[model samples]
Target: MRALHIITGLGVGGAEQQLRLLLRHLPADCDVVTLTNPGAVADGLAADGVRVVHLGMGGNRDLAALPRLVRVIRAGGYDLVHTHLYRACVYGRLAARVAGVRAVVATEHSLGDSQMEGRRLTAGVRALYLASERLGSATVAVSEAVAERLKRWGVPAPRIEVVPNGIELDRFRFDRERRTRTRRRLGLPEGAFVVGGVGRLARGKRFDVLVHALARLPEDHWLLLVGGGPEEHVLRRTAHEAGVAGRVLFTGERPCAPDGSPGPDLPSLTSAMDLLASPSAEEAFGLAAVEALASGLPVLYTSCPAIEDLPAAAATDARRVRGGPEAYARAIAEVRAAGPGPRTAPPAAHHYSITRSTARLMDVYAAALAGSSPSLAPLGASPS
Candidate 1:
């Protein structure tokens, strides 16, 4: 039950790769810290053995990193201290309440509707995020549209707690020979129709509205573009002013796990793709349109609170397409004239599965250590 996490910069986005995939399935004994560029999800959370720490936070009013993050949360005897993004939830809930660590928790992971991470919400950032969210006891919210945008940013629907972001359903399932060896190792071609765009090529991930909807398609359509940032040369000058710069590929920042890294690992670029456009009009938990509906692909999106709060037949190959780039070029040419379908994963990717979001985050860490510190120790039943 000795958790401790705190984040702000580990790089590779999506709430720093969903906090390195929720500290690899979290069963307690976790550890992490960042607060500044620790980069590459802090080397994949120190190659998954966890225990990372950097804290050199010199940015958001460092305040000398709040007593050096309260001396690394009081020398790490931590019983619980979760946190992620938004300047590590405002200096990890005031350094876990000055390191006494009364089981804090925080995970709003990008609140939207005017933005939080992409940074455009002011009034002193909602009074410093509702004043460090009243020094945390719980805050989760990765979906129910970011728990109704954190109860309209006043934050207290009994301290908000949706907990949806998750994956690892056999690492995004689909693999017909890994879609013909990741489309002949990314050169793609043999019957290409791709169109897949994952995330973080920034500019609010509009990804230049998938490069002007891949210049209104039809040239054997191919636009990959997986993760990488400061709008990778402004989305390669918006794929050369939407002339579709050589059918735009750009696989720069890939790693949703498969690290011997040098690209190609987001389930092998969502198995060489066929369709996963996410013209991100804004999203808190679209998670590459649920890992391209768990690699079954076919996702066209314009925001996804994890598939609009899951219902319409649990992601019938996910489709929303609202506007821009001619409404994703007539919804990717009506899904390429309705050709492909059954790749698999649908019940909205087994309803967000990373082991049921690590058993609802160990029941929000045993109800935030029994509401703040009923003598610690009881976050027991998590892994299923």
Candidate 2:
């Protein structure tokens, strides 16, 4: 089936990167339209022979662009329109309806009661979201936590589907050679204890908390911040004020490759890390933590819905520590004392593999096209 994927921006964030990965596995002829700033992800999509359209949306209030979006959807003869992130969900769903597309679906990649995309949650935003949501055939939540959150947001239970984000396990598998090379490339000393976190450096990500925690660690401990955002200067200042400025390394924004063959390979970076931290209280699925686990690195996270939901065997390497710099410091020390377990694939790896997620998403597409309205069953198993 012909599908059009719509997203807020093509920047290097979790949702954007996930869309790039999903395209690699989906068999349907799919194209992407970025609402604004078709950044790095757009180039990657174009490299893979997928068309990337820039809508040039002026701002959130650019309702005037809806007719143009509708025209494009209609002219493309798209059988399905799949929207990602918030703005795209709102506008794309409306456009799809206006274009008379047979089916429209959206992936709620990031949402919580407190915030979305680092912005404080407000009633007006919820009203806008719900109003646009009604136009789509289905809304896919990235985790069970997100699904329940949507329900609490007033969406009918039948309209929310759980489809956990997936990772390409083979790409993230531990490789000593890559560890050596990536560490060398990043100028990290061979014996330093490196703790890394991957995602946009946004306020909601709570990367500032990681800086404070790093300051509490031993002298040999270092921090690696990946991805870039408007908060970089603030985070850098936080690092300086924490007295760990010299110990902190920022890799700027790294392009995530679906096969991990090009750009700054995420798996390689994960390999270079001694530990992975996800201090964000707003994480939806924590794909980076899962990739770290797949890379055989122990993870310290404040919030990880998919990891928490995973069966114990599958999540043996992840720990959900209490929020605070001290708690994270203690968790890091404890993990260091225990050292790492045998390096092997976590038992739960297969469940979150790209192969399985792709199949489940295809099922959602098929269901949407079947004119299944109102009641929709959740896909993906509840974490065991």
- Among these predictions, the greatest TM-score belongs to 2
Report the C-alpha displacement of residue 33, candidate 2, in angstroms. 1.4
Task: Name the TM-score of candidate 2.
Answer: 0.93
Off by over 4 Å in 2: 256-264, 372-384
Residue 141 error, candidate 2, Å? 0.3
Q: How well is each residue in 73-99 modelled by candidate 2, as lDDT tens digits?
A: 877999999999999999998788777
Per-residue lDDT of 85 in model 1 = 75
Which digits, one per residue and each the tens of the lDDT, describe model 1 over residues 25-107?
Answer: 77878888888888776877787788898988789986878777777777888888988878888878877776667678898
* Model 1: colliding residue pairs: 202-205
Q: Which stretches of candidate 1 lie over 4 Å from their true place?
A: 1-4, 7-13, 18-49, 52-72, 77-91, 100-109, 114-128, 133-181, 185-193, 199-256, 260-277, 283-325, 330-384
Looking at candidate 2, the ten consecutive residues that score lowest on lDDT are 375-384
Provide the lDDT at 360 for model 2.
Answer: 93
lDDT of each: 0.81, 0.85
